[model samples]
Target: MTPIRHNHSDGDAVLDAVRDCVLAVGVRRTTMTDVARRAGVSRMTLYRRWPDVRSLVGDLMTREWVAAATDAMPERRPGTLTRDLIADGLVAGVAAFRAHPLFHKIVDVDPELLLPYVLDRRGASQEALLALLADVLREGHADGSVRQGHVERQARALLLIVQSFALSLRTMTDADDTELNGDAFLAELRGILERTLTP
Candidate 1:
């Protein structure tokens, strides 16, 4: 992909600038002035697009994440939710969050910022995650890997596990514990799902 340039004509360029500002100075310290400087756009132009930093960051993520999900998520296998969850889905999902400075900034500064992105009432990240889980569960059920029960409930439970794992990054960073034992967590999570959902 072509690196977005610093220009007003390109919305992605502005987002790229704002993302850079967040990375360089963190969320709170980054200001419109910094974004303008990084973007090579006039301050007036930046203000016209976004009244504040939160708004700019919010807009960028809201637009970007769905695309990332569809593009990066693994193809659905026939009957193995656990395999998909462990193999590619979880890794891609976490990698997406780790790669985005906006996610890190929000989680690092205040977990509440995750509310709009992950906890909104509509098709928020949680809902999107549930949909992803439901797809895998459907395949699993078809192939006899998943028990026939309330798929929605099971999907919601699975989504919460993933969401909490991602949100826990804040606490993990605060404790300065960077070594994430992904395998251990996956094993624990899978056990929980199997206990709850298996026939």
Candidate 2:
């Protein structure tokens, strides 16, 4: 039989606990016991929901990352163009993620945790983002703001571009440099998205 999933509040508690534990101990050391203790749930409760720390952490990452992306998206105004919205949203999303404490911690301490999502397969959060992007791209298509194409293809392509910048941008940055910088690359990202989507 399949195990029951956490209800809204209970899931939040568990995921929030997972976040705290991972933030403090890193994914390498965090365990189901740690999450259960932090969440004030029984080990059996956590075990029913998630078999291991990595699975629990995966769910936590989905929750936190999706929330970050939603919060980072600009509220669309009556006159706002979709391409503009997409460009601004992508740039803001990248900045928000880079600044996120959880993201920073994982990247700094448990970088390999992300390798599966990066090199192997799309995570729940990524699949969610792709669906949202496809819908938004459909809107842009209706408005003639986005170039006409297979919506899924366009959405995946856009995600690929943003993912690279959001995930790997730090490797190419030098804060002290004047010519090449994070901000400069972000601007370039904006231009690329705008041009890619603009009809």
Candidate 3:
């Protein structure tokens, strides 16, 4: 897929508008006009860039996912353990998604909007996540910490694992559940990932 180019400030404003609008009124009710008004841009500007709300929202979601991944990326340091880096990155990524106001709002209010990406169709967000994980796994492989395997397959599996945690965490735990709180869950997830990737 070709990346859309926009002025950084304008693109941020547009994405921020979409996030706010989705959180405020749900995806189905968020119109291009609404986004334009919130972004302080005319509808024509949005129309020229994106054909409809779905396309615009797709870009918005991709931007958010990339930002979260980039922010969560681990710093490379000498003697750093690959599993530690993976665990830290996954924890940070999941935390970012959990902390996003629009994320929970979408899950609670308009889950169908996410079904296409979750089901058979792979979205740009998923592709970006796969690429990020692949790069990390490649580094681990070069360091002889990760098992030799298909990098793409490993990356996809990791993406699915993390995505499940990010999107369905509420379904997996309850307020009264003691064993599956955030920290405990992350610890277990880290252990699982460490085992999975170890040579």
Candidate 4:
């Protein structure tokens, strides 16, 4: 059995090192030794805290990504989900996706890194998004801007489209077509929602 090391600061330093390695070499290639060297710790120290790269990656996703998703949600306005989705929220989401180096590198090096977060539909990020959508939908319906009957389904559908686009964009090699025209997507989405959802 491997002996456990109980220094909180060392554990944090090792995780941070792992995150850096992930960005530099990606998840699959980032070994415990690499993280330990980067963190100025021993491999035994890292292994004591996290058994393997898989466990470390899973913790990183759950801790970092979940917090990011939850913290990034814009404040809800009851009658303005469409405006929020089209104008500020969607734009912010796109910008965030573009700016996230770790996310980009993960997909670039190993697309499967995205699988648990995207394809499975049960990741921390997805759950956070669903909760946000539910709140927005409830607000929209309460203010009579969104129709009540199909609120949940429509919200999920809208989220799915955005998620799909994001995933596709990550894998795209052509910048010309791959670049997200935020305004265009939002305009089209708003038009569809207005036509279908307005009473």
lDDT of each: 0.63, 0.87, 0.82, 0.64
Q: What's the candidate order when arranged by decreasing lDDT?
A: 2, 3, 4, 1
Model 4 steric clash total: 0
Task: Predict model 2's lDDT versus the native.
Answer: 0.87
Residue pairs with backbone atoms closer than 3 Å in model 3 (clashes): none
Across 82-157, the per-residue lDDT of candidate 3 in tens digits comes to: 7668877887788788888777787888888888977878899889778877877887899898888999999998
Runs in model 3 with CA error above 4 Å? 1-7, 179-181
Model 1 Cα lDDT, one tens digit per residue, 1-199: 1111334556777888878877666777889888888888898998887899888877666555655555556665555365444335554565566566567666667557667555556444456556767776776677665677677887776666666665664454444444564545545544665565565
TM-score of each: 0.63, 0.93, 0.90, 0.67
| RMSD after Cα superposition, model 2 | 4.8
Which scores higher on TM-score, 2 or 3? Answer: 2
Q: Which stretches of candidate 4 lie over 4 Å from their true place?
A: 1-15, 36-50, 67-72, 75-87, 116-121, 150-155, 170-183, 186-199
lDDT of 2 by residue, 101-133 (tens): 999999999999899988999999999888878
**lDDT per residue, candidate 4, 1-199, as tens digits?**
0112335676577668878999888999999888878999888877777899978877665555544444455665555454344334544564566456776787778778777666555765566566666766676677676667665676677667666655664354355654364545545644654665564
What value of lDDT does candidate 3 attain over all alpha carbons? 0.82
What's the CA RMSD for each of the models?
Answer: 5.7, 4.8, 3.5, 7.3
Q: Is candidate 1 or candidate 4 better by TM-score?
A: 4
Question: Alpha-carbon error at 11 in model 1, in Å?
Answer: 2.8
